[model samples]
Target: MGRNTRKRRTPLATKIVAGAAALAVGGGGLVWANFYASAHEDHGGHNRTRSAGAQVATIDCPDVGQKIRDVPDRARGEVDGELASMDSQITDAYQRLATTRRAQAGDARFVENSILGPLKERRKALIDRIQLEINRAGGKADDNLDELAGCQGRPADQQQDGDGQDGGGGQDDGQNGGGQDDGQNGDGQNQDDNGNGVAGPVADDFIDINDVQPNSRNSRNGLAADGDGGSTGTFSTDCGVNENNLFNSDNLIAAPGVDNGAHHTHDYVGNQDNDAFSSDEDLANADTSCQNQGDKSTYYWPVLRLQDGTQEFDANDQGGGAEGNIGKILKPAQAELKFVGSQQGDVVAMPKFLRIITGDAKSFTNGDANANTSWSCSGFEDRQVTDKYPLCPEGSQVLRTTNFQSCWDGQNIDSANHRDHMAFVQEDGSCPEGFQAVPQLQVRLAYDIPTPTVENGQVRNPYAVDSFPEQLHKPITDHNDFINVMDENLMNEVVDCINRGEDCQ
Candidate 1:
């Protein structure tokens, strides 16, 4: 292979998600176990190197769970314990994969065959045993092992069936696990007097199209919101599935906690398994609790919390926080969601199976100087705002604005960089020459953290995202993803709302 030859992960290890229904634990939370890749490198099979910004291909695992229902009663514990073990082994193997990839001479096939393949077998065996327990428990072992097996190590491209569409099979267990799976039980179990629980929502559940938050707040600095001023058409919707405890095993890139893939968890809304490895077909069929029923779009990010000391709201809530790693999840004391158009032309319905990412994931280091970020206090954008994460005052909330480009090049649904196919809205909020203007999605996340405490004569940093021991955590590290599943009627309604300048629920 040439020096620029990016190692393509041939179908070897498929993704196996412990779907929300079957993997849901006692407390109502859900989890899954898998080790797979998410996306591909933009470069032609090249060794990923930062010197030239080479993107390396990775092992994108399939999201599995719906096939196997969780065994009922205490027997569930046995399967869960085994699942936990599989998660650990997978995480360890992938951590090694990540480490080896960093070396110039890293061999992708060797990593898959030697490091990851063995773990896969171990995991399969454990899952087989879990299935037996489910059958013995009278829960009906209706899981499709064939389907689950098919998910292992398949490419995103081949995910489609012969019909050339995303082939989503199996059933949506319908047992919503967002509230229960994140190490807590019941709705509002983690919420306190301040309202920071997994299912607790704040502010207006629906945003008025005419009343949008200021896209740009930085004055002294020339920084603009990622998609600010570029909005030609705009509408708002509620951020879906705001639960924090899902152990979604379909992470494309193996971050710090890749071994127990889902342990280093996130707060998910919208389509439940919105992790890196999810596809359009999977998202489309996902049972969501968001408004506009058929809209199956998925959106997710790291959960933010107060690191000081609350049993459930402790430091472990952030990314890699479970591993005693360096990063912490920063919450926006407040959040907002909106859609903008990237062109002067009428906003059109986003095609099905569209994939897009906001912010940048590669840059989320532990706690380094992060550039290309926008932060502000809920009410005081003038003073409490800066590129640095501003700690919220008592009763005040912090806000981070992430705007994704909406113009599609009309060719590829996704790119190696998770960006290439999509272009940002122009300063005039219009799409460029060959691009079509779609609704640019905006996610405004809020956090609840007080001023950094002065400990040992120094102020500590509070607002941050997940980071690993090796990966330097940076602010630009905060990133999110989206796959539109809005039903045609709902999407058209949004398009009409933007075109007619009418406010809506």
Candidate 2:
């Protein structure tokens, strides 16, 4: 891989100082904070502040999807379209902020007055349209949405996800470790390899694996307790590591029919016809990348890129460099997709087209309440770090592990926020009430990337996961998307293998 040769922009003013803030832990043990102010929120006027001698890092907007509990079936299409438009507005505003660093340094309120102000107005208009769509379909519009239209400017190096402590057990029994690297020099202004000065993946976002304490989860290994009927079998599916180079920025589940909805490219495997405009019938008939033709399920996640200067095919595209995600995309050395049974009881077959999204793509601004990223090194799999990218030693491959939700609500194939239909297993390895255990899909991707360097607070040739422009390419924002399209017989076979304590491929 070529070394990152892009000219890094140095902030003209004093470097940003870290901010002292607290995160409010939300559901699923995730952490969050109210970044928007209340008054004039209806008109998109929220309190935005920059710390003394600090720079505005990225835009922080309320997640409109999370706030909208329900959209009538007839209004779903229009509501989704408006949400996609809101994302585009944020991307446009961020692009302007990134390209106007010099102007921002010259004017104290340039970011607020020029970029954020107009961005909020646009968001408010879109949000109003969303309200109208829901009400027109005879569905109740959320009252809190008026306050969600406004976004604020967050200072650089503000802590969002991990606690200040160095090492600790994770929030679940499955994985007992999650923490972000807390190393910030705060000495120099630096731009990522993409040349986006304010958007991040700064030097502090990486940590050496040797520095992390061992915090792996205590797995039940699909074993059942006395009298407990647990499914103990395993099934493995062989899907190529996106060798076909299936790449796109569309999020079919979140913003269907909207091009470039993701604002970042994804590496796809499994179903061949997965994209923004793909319908259920299209996916069912699509060619399969999996070794088993019956397993046409679609699996995808954000592509990991080496910050080297080499421009890939999407270098000039909207979801690529144009949105601040630029680099040479790296193909995973190994992509392992496995299905394991529940520890508490037998697992049922996943409904076809059941969509599940793990982790929060906007964790940098929304906090880590829903963040489930587990990054480690090959030899250091037991030491997983959620918020920080690991600097694996020579000969050790970098690893990204994703453990999907194993419990399903059994009714709907999808939910409004794309999350209410599924739930993670409880600490005791049991499913929640009204949820049944399903074969949990675990994805592990290994990459052979050279360790990046942090010199005088400037990161050189770092490897970062693709992210939304305003998310700053934070590792905590890493996420995965899945659509179960397995044929009925194959899914039943998977359930049978798990329930019968047998291993099958």
Candidate 3:
């Protein structure tokens, strides 16, 4: 979310900080031993050990966004700014790791002493500041926030095998795909990074859609299975697939007022005026791309790009090639936004300015607890994968689907973590005790991307979603954001149409 000039909160000052893991030497030996002992013990109590000489791939930090859930309204803006800064710190550190290969090889403690150590200290300072803000606002901060400041160096092939839990670069039962490869390109120019010597979207990241087993998912909404009862109706909105080329790297929800907070570009639809500085009133007064003038909501997600060495506009910019997100941006061929009723009963009208984020953008490191991925081919929509990128056969197109949380807390339009205010349906397909079901927003994005080639375990001309440099462009990190700005009359009309079991646009 970009903004014009204003005396705003401090922004992240770009500075290169080393990030990677290498053999501990000199002053880093004790720290490495401690890290090794703790990393094996602390990740959700799942003890998995890596070999002593296993290559440390990337920095794995505990996501503070999920913590500090009790921030007060008065302190939220400041805390959010600090959280955004933390992300930038990691990005800069990763840049150093990705670019300085010779330094890491020559000095055994280069990564630990120069990269991981400083990162921990900086994160600790930010965490302390968050605690102070919460306490000042009469909110109870999490007692163990200090413990989250430290991060571990994850191995390249590490997988979270035991317990099928999220957290730490574990492949949770196919939730985050298979083991990560060395992210080499078919051309074999750069061996460690992606084909472009940037971050990732390794050769193993993609799988043919035909190879995935069919019928792995059961119908959740009842309308798909022709079942009786439930609202069983739908309302579609005709927002173009960002044909106007509105793009940015700001996250208005998580990092409002911070530029390039997303560290990668996003494609926007519906609202024409959206950025980190967009207030509710600003959005209400802005123009919209929706055919219906009454609906001025905002919808956005990471943009997909083809890794064919094409330099887009942001090639030399902060959130583009400079940060390892290099390639030609791919426009979606189709973007469908639909509202559906719940399986249990009819849904009520959503309040205006309601915000919802459907997936986790940092799922690569933070785990799959918030991952909401749905990748498949146009013809093979029945077979969806959460982690692996789908390689559609000839004549078929790639598709990405997102189902927003339907159950609202009925109190707040937003939450501190941007997630607690909404909830997904339970196993029995009903809303929770104190929640009410609302129209679920299902977004389907289709792309007419050319199938990539793989030879000798290296991909060529691959397509991947833009992501945080440390996220490695993994598919599980895909996410979407929405803010409902529909007029009251239109909102009521949508609810009415759903209750009446009719489809309307």
Candidate 4:
């Protein structure tokens, strides 16, 4: 202070500012050194940065043009490849189906040799193979095309940018990518929104069987009757004949003089007084003789004939009594015969004869050449005709064999009967063996049961004679039109996906 030499006093404010500026410069220099060190890091850190650098670098590539100009061409190429593969599979399947159809037809030679036994197995294998191929191709083509169409350009770091917006040494940002945006102008590609390739004018070459409805009437089994009251029960001739008094009793073989086999003695009294009594006496004596022989008082029998013209006895008929002799009872000339019986424990014994024919009397021969060529009979008759006399009642007319012909009424003869009988007259005039007049019940079963055929190792309707209009309309050149429609629909959907730049999977 005494030297006054402390020339000028420095200001406190200026001194403080100078110190702050110095500190700021030092801190800035440290930060710059740290950044430089990181940029030039060693291999260990270098690798990590390199990974990120790759992504960033790729983003610089020009954004894939919004035109997506390559999609249609690529998709079409893929579609063509898939179509070729599908064609091969389809061809194989068609061949198999054809082979199966041929086998099922069973030419006369194949039937004789049983050569078609393996046809079904072959068909199945081929179908499975073709189906697998179709599925594989369908999935691959669908997914691949979709993936290609949806492919987006990499980010800025991954792709080189053609523009020079950033500094010459600018770092890349990994955000830019290419793909269809949500905007309406989307990728300049046309695609069916519903994902059905059928949106455009349908190709004439393409076939879809699904458009046609199947024919329900193709079933091989015949139609069933509409009413519950229709035929029921099996037709059979198992009953045995009666053996007691033949003339008047219900026995198959009644004696000549006793009324033992008599069943309707009371019914005959008013019509013929003396005749009734005489018949009753004859039946009684026959009954006595049968008992002596250890035979039942009454027995029954059925008449069975074979195609070979052989006949067998089933059950015996009950004999008539006092009212009129059983032998004297009349039956309609043109009636079908039905034998009613009672079950003796488990065995049914023949009882009475019922006639089915109505209207006028009809004559039928037992195929006996020596028998009467013609005979008169009532419209309906129930009495048995002796082997020697082929005739109906005095007032009836005769029906020649020519009058009977085959006709079906679509009604089952019987509902309860499961047994079936097929009667056919051979051109040789010989009848089949073991054939008997079928009861109403058995006829229905034969007409209704479905006939089976082997197809692709499985039993199917081989004898199916019915077809629908749609089936007939199908082109013989291609079977795709005949496959289930749903499968075709799915294939169309996949195709649509390929048309549009969308992910099919």
Best by TM-score: 3
**Runs with alpha carbons beyond 4 Å of true place in candidate 1:** 1-233, 240-264, 275-279, 309-319, 325-334, 364-372, 382-387, 455-457, 460-463
lDDT, candidates in the order shown: 0.42, 0.72, 0.73, 0.19
TM-scores of the models, in the given order? 0.50, 0.82, 0.85, 0.12
Q: What lDDT is obtained when candidate 1 is compared to the true structure?
A: 0.42
Best by lDDT: 3
Instruction: Give lDDT for model 4.
Output: 0.19
Ranking by TM-score: 3, 2, 1, 4
The stretch of ten residues in a row with the least summed lDDT in candidate 2 is: 23-32
Q: Which stretches of candidate 4 lie over 4 Å from their true place?
A: 1-228, 235-237, 241-505
| Candidate 4 local lDDT, 214-333, one digit each (tens) | 331121111211123322221122112211112122111211122222122211111111111233333233322221222212211111011111110100111111111111122112
Question: How many backbone clashes are present in model 4?
Answer: 99
Candidate 1 lDDT at 29 equals 18
Sorted on lDDT, best first, the list reads 3, 2, 1, 4
Q: Write candidate 2's Cα lDDT for 1-505 as tens digits.
A: 2111112132112221211111011110001011111111122224333221125556889899877877888898889899999999988877675555545645677778888889889998998999999999999998668888888776553444453312321111111011111112222223332232224466667789988778653332223322346788889999899877777788888988888889998888999888888889989999999999999999999999886655556654567665667667998999999998887878999999999998889877777667776899999877878878899999999999888888899998888788988998887888899999999988889999999986654566778899898787888789999999999999999999989988899
Q: List the residue pairs that clash in candidate 3.
A: 1-250, 160-170
Better of 2 and 4 by TM-score: 2
Residue 65 error, candidate 2, Å: 0.7
| Native-to-model Cα distance after best TM-score fit, residue 462 in candidate 4, in Å | 55
Question: For candidate 3, lDDT tens digit of each residue in 52-140?
Answer: 22235567899998887979999999999999999998887765555444455445576787788899999999999999999999999
